[model samples]
Target: MSFRPVIISLVVLALAGLALAFAPTGTTARPDQGDARPFQLRDTEGNLVTDTSLRGQVVLLYFGYTFCPDVCPTELGYVARVLRAMGDDVERTTPLFVTVDPERDTPELLKGYAPLFHPRIRALTGTPEELAAVFKTFGVTARKVPGAGSHYLMDHSSSITVLDRQGRVAATIGSTDTIARSVTTLRDILGKP
Candidate 1:
């Protein structure tokens, strides 16, 4: 049993496992092309937003509450950095801050908080029903937990779901740990020749 042969066999097995685990699900075609899922939600101004409105743009959908003490802002800050890296490319992209705490985050509240991160970012909130539908559609979950007074913590999926030009979910950026990965993912998805 030569050590070289054993090592080579192990390496080949590992490579095969990696390939199977990461193989494209074919659920999302290349970012450059594909039919994306249609997404519709209300802007902070209460205007109805349709999926067609996001055409030819890379959209990052972040689900969090404005009252969030840290995670939300940190994630948004990373998004700001990514946008800055993009520079003019930001024109073709948008960061959307969708509120999980609609009770306290109204259209006006969102409007005030979102722009603090970036000029291109837009915040949105809607009725609980509307938010629930959107969350379900995107596979993000949000639940309210009891808290002090009228305040409560919302347990939501802390992942930034990236939507390609066609409004399909291209990838997910999880928590703050994936900021660098997100920047790379965005740059790669933007595909700026």
Candidate 2:
């Protein structure tokens, strides 16, 4: 008749529920296995960028906003390093920076921000409704965190979604993955050494 065991079981169950609630969406699919959800958004030049338009190239897609103080820049820096390390092989790759905060991350601002990391990175944004569809397609979650009046921060997921030549998800690099790891993943997808 010990209630200790029952209390421990309840606590464990609670913890499991919490973990499930906060877990990120999306399944990690192996190379060339899962079909990437299609999307269309506008690039910095007001050009419509779509999944179908990038069929023959490998894509490195990252989601974040220009105003992100640290994490976004760090992740983008890693992406730039990976591109540089690719050498001539970079020509076959397309690096994309998709803004999760379209309200503030206009194409004009993104045009300035993206090239600061690398000349090849194309920044994109779209209408809020359009962005929401793309976000769901990529299993990206973004929320606005209220800060001081008239200013706020966005809380969002950080990860790189790698797509192969066929526009299918080849791999998903975690936020903590190193540049070397990211390069390796890209190479594997690109079938390069």
Least lDDT summed over 10 consecutive residues: which range in candidate 2? 25-34
- In order, what lDDT does every prediction score? 0.78, 0.86
Give the poorly placed runs of model 2, Cα more than 4 Å off: 1-32
lDDT tens string, model 2, 133-155?
88888778788999998999998
What's the residue-level lDDT of 134 in candidate 2? 85
Clashes of each: 0, 0
The alpha-carbon RMSD values of the candidates against the true structure, listed in the order shown, are: 8.8, 3.0
Displacement of residue 8 (Cα, Å) in model 1 is 45
Name the lDDT value of residue 16 in candidate 1.
Answer: 100
Least accurate 10 contiguous residues by lDDT in model 1: 24-33
Candidate 1 TM-score, C-alpha based: 0.76
Estimated TM-score per prediction?
0.76, 0.85
How far residue 166's Cα lies from its native spot in candidate 1, in Å, is: 1.2
